[model samples]
Target: MIGPATPEGTLFEGRVHHMSIERLLAFSGGPFTLNHWPARNLHIDPEKAAEAGFPAPVASGLQAQGHIIRLLIDLLGDAWSRTGSFHSRFRRPVFAGDSIQAKARLAARRAEAGVTQYTFDVWCERHDGEIAVVGTAACTVHEPNPGVQAA
Candidate 1:
């Protein structure tokens, strides 16, 4: 089942399908271990990250994207896996202890062949409210988009 569509010209449009995630991976801001590639220019290794100009070990961008995928799926439905797409930009590094929240707002919608495609403004924000990642998400489903003109 698809989620509700945000109507144009309404304040509740964005909230109709609102979603939030408190924390993901929620680890203490400390050193991590990866046997295969120890301190080899990766986020899990502080020394390598420092050498690469990063203050500390940084989480993987894919990890952040995974959170987004979950948010989009929850906002839409299980059907998202088949037609969902994401365009993301890594804006900041996620430290080990920094909490991450996934948030999304409905952006636009349109109809195609038979499925409706919905676009969303999505991002991963740190606990401090800084955006660590920003992107747009699209999910195509069979549900009709109410209060939206399929263009």
Candidate 2:
């Protein structure tokens, strides 16, 4: 059986990491969504979404990004916060009440001098298996733990 991922796992090419937003956990940013803060918007009000042509409120793209970041942190620990960079494109609308999963596969890992660089192909998949977001993320570490070399 596979074990939980940890920084000590020697992050290797092809390893996978993930996080999820269950159907029960989907949320509207609401007050935090300053554009429509505390008021009706495409993200917090279904009626507003209909006005704009969508059937229901859509979650922010950044929310999906947040889940991907959480997966990275779980897999890479603090190294992700200090040196990670991410770029993403929203492919399909993530509507309210949808269940989605943010997944990452380590696509590259290299070490030279005192630096170790890691890259991942990341995506968010809707419950029905359609991709909702896609991106690449990378992190660089200086003088990483000797035990953490890529396997």
Candidate 3:
């Protein structure tokens, strides 16, 4: 079993990491997309995208979530290997040219039997300071000892 993510109420705050065109393209593992994603690709060029008032093609909502997940996993390490679930709601659009950041707040923790459960407040925001996503997450840390109790 995996160990606990942290002692609970342990805040995990991080700054946004900018993703460039090349970086985003690499991370996505595909060609650039101009559409709303998961369905269509309007194929809007940079000029048209700018003319339309958006700095660039809007990024897929999933991409932002993936970035946040990567950040959490990097920080928590193996604790998330098999003991956590993430849920988020997209609140705004993120353009490919925009930078973004993720922040998480440890809200609570509970111990039962041998497992420790943790709840957190999670969110992602764009470089322009727009909140693109907000949600909560739950994770179970491995018991301190499968055979021992906290005496």
Which candidate leads in TM-score?
A: 2
Q: For model 3, how does the per-residue alpha-carbon lDDT over 24-95 read when each residue is reduced to its tens digit?
A: 555543444736432323122456457667667666677787777765665555566577688899998777
> What is the descending TM-score order?
2, 3, 1
- Tens-digit lDDT track of model 1 for 1-151: 2344455322111111111111222222233454442334445666867888887667777776677777676556655667788899999877656777777777776766667777878888877777888988787777653422321
* Model 1 worst lDDT window (10 residues): 11-20
Which segments of candidate 3 are over 4 A away from where they belong?
A: 1-9, 29-55, 144-151
Q: What is the lDDT of residue 133 in candidate 2?
A: 84
Question: Per-residue lDDT for 38-126 in model 2, tens only?
Answer: 55567767788899999877777777677788777765666777888999998998777777777777777677786778788888887
Candidate 1 vs. true structure, TM-score: 0.68
lDDT of 2 at 99: 71
The predictions' CA RMSDs to the true structure, in order, are 7.3, 6.3, 6.5
Model 3 TM-score, all chains together: 0.69
Between prediction 2 and prediction 3, which has the larger TM-score? Answer: 2
C-alpha lDDT (0 to 100) for residue 124 of candidate 3: 87
Per-candidate TM-score against the hidden true structure = 0.68, 0.72, 0.69
Better of 1 and 2 by TM-score: 2
